[model samples]
Target: MKMKFEFQFPDIGEGIHEGVITKWLVKEGDMIKEGDSVAEVETDKVTTEIPSPKTGKIIELKASNGDTIHVGDVFVVIDTEGSAEEVSSEDKKDTLAEKKEIVEEENAGVVGEVISSSEVIAPSDEKEGNSASENVAGKALATPVARKLAKDLGVDINKVVGSGPNGRVMKEDIIKASKQPSEAEHKEVLDETVKTTVDAKEEKIIVEEEKIERIPLTRIRKTISQKMTQSRFTIPHTTAMDEIDVTQLYEFRKKYKDSLKEEEINLTFMPFIIKATISVLKKMPEFNATLDEENDELILKKFYHIGIATDTDRGLMVPVIRDADRLSIIELAKKVDEVSNSAKNNQIELKDLKGSSFTITNYGSIGGYYGIPIINYPESAILGVGRIVQKPVVKDDEIVKAWILPLSLSYDHRIIDGASGARFLNMMRELLENPEMLLLKA
Candidate 1:
């Protein structure tokens, strides 16, 4: 007797509703163990590996690669040694009742009466029922659209007083609540009026708006947009910026390029930056943690798996360089080149991008001076490196030429504060300015 279990898509983060199947790691008839990777699911923010929840033979794949699957939609089926009837009678009863309740709710009217004919439910009457539920539950009862709007605007529905009939919350109510200025705005206005003398201030000027064109988002771009919106609204982000003098690093790279060429290795600045970041992260372990909201726990990683942000023709991809702490600078340079080339050619495997403990983005390659990169959710922080420029600096009370690299560090404020973030950035700067430290450790 063979038994089957359906593995539905799990919520990756926040309350995301769906994800696209980027690739399937296992095929039908493959024997899989519990916790083995099953598929790569690409949400709007990141492409993450989904593992097998139970050990069994995969009998069927419910969805194909590139197909969009919603939350609770079955994506895989596993066959065991028992038939469906072997499930306990109590479990069968519970399942049947749940199905019946869903059907009944679909067919029933707002007041609990069965609708006998084809008729549209009045929005007004539905609003009343929702309001009544809210009153009984002591929370705002909102439609899915209204809830999604509130989420995008970062508004708390409970604090928003509904203006619709029977106090049913509406999207308009949420928008109005978000638009209400805080007491700080009022204070600022009063202070401005007081500071400006009778005729000293200039007249306010209004500028006409320019026409904006809308473009459809690509698959990767769409995911980026949704994830960024979610991060901005859900997580409190604080940024720390610092500048490091990398003159010694520039000279060292130039000195070693020919030697590296002899070994068939293409040396780059990214590997050195990545090594320095991993070293600093090892010292500040809290910067390499994840928030397990369900368990109310913080997971700190001891090993370092660094994510290298690669800009490809398709989009932005961060392929991980696993165990960077253990690899030599030359080894790291080779791995970076391999991963980056793979990402550019679209030959990178899903596993190559998973299990990153930290991430570093080299915006300097494109001449960006500084940038506040988003925290790759589930990871505590990300390091951004800007272009190295020769600028004037004061040395021994005199100005001189110095090569400076601007660094931007963004972390989840809920987990780490400004002081810790600053310390982490400073340590990275010190390591980069003096590459000998990294070599000594190696």
Candidate 2:
């Protein structure tokens, strides 16, 4: 006597409609406890594991590896009641039927919002329903966005495998599948079924064959594009570039490098730079403010939360350091190390990745020099630090060897002007050049 229950893919987050089933942790007949990981689904920004809802034995796997599952489709079926249970098969069936009737009656008006084909949608305030492009019995399942993206990319939605829940096609899967080589003389087929009003007169059309391959953007890449575009268009950007010598700053770090290493905190140039930026931001509050374009207001932040831009295999991620103004140089170094390590390993959480008064991108660490970094939107500005190179400088009335750092300060021209940006930057350069100023804030 076993009671079978199906588990559908749950809505992970807003705007996240589907997922690609990367791998299954359990096979059929494997006994699992409630909350045990059953499968890994790669979604936007995070690779999440679907957990078992109840203690049971997996009787059937509805999805295969690399399959896309939709929000409402069943992925696994489990028998909660064991075969040795006291209840008979007939009794279990009768109870299940009663439960089904109750569920159907309650969800009578919301059949389209089904979470599971056989199971009832939960009684929650949150809305549930697949997009219009959801696959029916004979149609290819896909989200409306996926279908539109496919059309834009000149791809056949049917050819793209849905990695979403219950084999539902997602935007990522469509983009990935479109990367595959097609026929040498392949021509993009337009979806003529989509209704559009056009003059009934004959129009000349030419199909240019230039051997072009269209690459679809990943979700992370798509997000980056949208954010970057918004930042470019919404804000009138201005860049302030300067060079500073860090001879004393280098020596200051060199003095305590061995001592900091003993505390398990790797001393990097970032923490020192962050401390200097924080001090400058505190004195110049306008630099750490957001311009409310809609309300015609500028909101100045009192607390200093600095965002560190880190490059990962997925994409560029910025994790914030809260209360950055309160931390010492050594503390900032440890925090920077923790966040950087977590970002590189992809172990950072959503909460840890958000909330920043300002952002700093150290392109210098990767050997880059002089980059006008786009301001992380809503935030007023972003500071870009380039490589520190040894160069000849006029010191004590003589050309001497010094470490020079390239700095690019890109800010919202609407809120921050040339004179203000220069003032803020000059203060930052002053602190960077004279490491003694760092101790004032520390």
Candidate 3:
């Protein structure tokens, strides 16, 4: 009772069309059961493992590592309780022939057949209009430098007779070969190669490639590039910059930094910024809305899902905090730590990265001053926070040092005017400057 089954690659996530095979967990002829993982695949959205549907022995793996497989394509074949004897001799022969054909097809472009001959052939004479460039093995032997010189002189090294030991081509041989051409067309080409008044030997020089390194973009990097390009091109972005005097807020955070640390909760300025931004977004509903281009309308989101832009080794990822308006500052701090760690470790879920009404990027964590961050499209705007530095400010006609935080607000010009954008940043500054007002309003 042997049956053959072809397993198709399923759609692992919504809107996933294709995936690259990252690894193979099972090979052909291996026994497996239902729910066993067969391969790990990376799509534009996420990386996950594809599992088997039936319990059987693996008969064939249709795709190899790094191959791209589309949804509904057969990726593997399984044999249910099938033995080798169950296959007839004709089928076995056919399988062997198919495998041989595949090997030949793959190697035709890159691999050459080795040819050997025992018969001896005499070398061509110089006056016979023939070249004695090839050896008994039918290939020219030349040093890399000689080959480079031949290339620069527009001379085919394979057709030039070398005078060195064992017919090894030298720089002098290449220069001589350039001056004498056996064929009329080749001689014309050499004349054109030496168009300058200088002699061929004096003009010939090998130009080496510039010193640089090239690296292929990873899957996450490609996705980030595509999304950023789309957002920048589709939206007309305008950034407004300002500085906030957060002397009181800085003192407020320092008082609770140690108390929160004892409870295993790390305190940072991000949660306070998040709270202030959320309060401003609620009042200015247009900031938390998306433009419906097809219908010519603005769709405002009722719920507060804030996106925190996190930097990881892979790239920048924005993970959303759902219902952020309902969470306290302490809860927001805990959730921020959890999601950021997950993104850095590559353990974050797909759902956690979507459904954000607005985003905030804190480049200040890494000592960046002010940056014009691109608005994460489909959302109307993004908030950028810069480093807090102590500087002297005139207070009561006297100079005093105060902590100043810089802010950059980028918004879509199609929906928001310059005045509206400035008002948004001013509201955030007011909330951050007064801790009592931020706690009461947020």
Whole-model lDDT per candidate: 0.69, 0.72, 0.74
Score candidate 3 by lDDT: 0.74
Q: Quick one: ranking by TM-score, best first? A: 2, 3, 1
Model 1: per-residue lDDT, tens digit, 240-309? 9998988899899999999989999999888888888877777888888887778888899988888888
The TM-score of candidate 3 is 0.69
> How does candidate 2 fare on TM-score?
0.72
In candidate 2, the residue pairs with backbone N, CA or C atoms under 3 Å apart (3 or more residues apart, or in different chains) clash, namely: 68-162, 68-163, 68-164, 69-163, 69-164, 69-165, 69-166, 70-165, 162-169
lDDT by residue (tens digit), candidate 2, 1-442: 5777767788876445666677899999899999999999865455778898878888878666655566765678789875333223333433332222111111111100112122131211112243324434334455444555678657887666566644456667766766665875257665543322211122111225323333434445655666677688888899999999998999988998999788888988888899889888878888899998778899999989899999889778788899988788888888998988887887877667667889999999999999989988878999999999999999789999999999999999887789988998798888889888778755
Q: All candidates: CA RMSD in angstroms?
A: 15.0, 10.6, 14.4
Q: How accurate is candidate 1 locally (lDDT)?
A: 0.69
Give stretches of model 2 more than 4 Å off.
Answer: 11-18, 64-73, 82-216
* lDDT tens digits by residue: candidate 3, 66-183: 6556666567778866534233322343332222110001111000010111121111111222223435334455543455567766788777787764455556887777777566
- Backbone clashes for every candidate come to 2, 9, 0
The candidate maximizing lDDT is: 3
Clashes of 2: 9
